[model samples]
Target: MSERRSISSGSVFEERIGYARAVVDGDRVHVSGTTGYDYATMSIADDVVAQCAQAIRNVEAALAEAGCTLADVVRVRYLLPDRADFEPCWPTLRAAFGEVRPAATMLVCGLAEPAMRFEIEVDARRR
Candidate 1:
């Protein structure tokens, strides 16, 4: 059987919601949907572009803990409350994912909190 482990980023939501930031099962890493909120400060930027950047950083942190990098990511999902906000985030998204070119999807939907303008989730394989 493959070994299974979970990683946390010390976010209040993790404890309240009872979920890990990411779960590592053998070489495969499944990162939870991460928002712009900085776990350390519990703060989120109002701007979607800034939120996108921060969300990317949060996802990267989880990937790192799972012994993987952005290059290892094979799939990604972007969630936004507004469809129009997606295009403005293109440059930032491309900067992080342009090289890796992982299979991706974007959904326009309501988030847990109204303040959350963007969220990101990823799946990666440890090399």
Candidate 2:
């Protein structure tokens, strides 16, 4: 049987957020909802596009930690604070996943942090 492993960069959430950044089980890796915040600095980027890019980067970093890459991603979830923001950032997302063409869903809703404009999460598998 395969074992489950938690993916963390030694960061901790002060609140009672019952979640890990990512989890690896066998050949599969699942990343939790990731925001635009720079985990190193814990600050959200100012630009929406930049934030979107950073969010994806963070996802990729998590995947890499699990011995995976963006190409291994099979699904993604994008959460935007507004539809307008989603429209403008659609192209960026498409370009990022152009080759992978992972199944994706975009949503608009309030995020945990006000400064966060976009959040992304992904699921990846490796053989």
lDDT of 2 by residue, 1-127 (tens): 9979988754455235767788999988999988877778877778899899888888888888999999999999999888788877878887889899999998889998788899898999976
Please, what are the lDDT tens digits per residue for candidate 1 over residues 15-52? 99999999999999999999999888999999999999
What shift in Å separates residue 42 of candidate 1 from its native position after superposition?
0.4
Which ten residues in a row are the worst by lDDT in model 2? Answer: 9-18
Question: Model 1 — which ten-residue stretch has the worst lDDT?
Answer: 60-69
Positional deviation of residue 74's Cα in model 1 after best superposition, in angstroms: 0.4
Candidates' lDDT values, in order?
Answer: 0.95, 0.85
Among all candidates shown, the one with the greatest lDDT:
1
Clashing pairs in 2: none
Which residues of candidate 1, in runs, are more than 4 Å off?
none
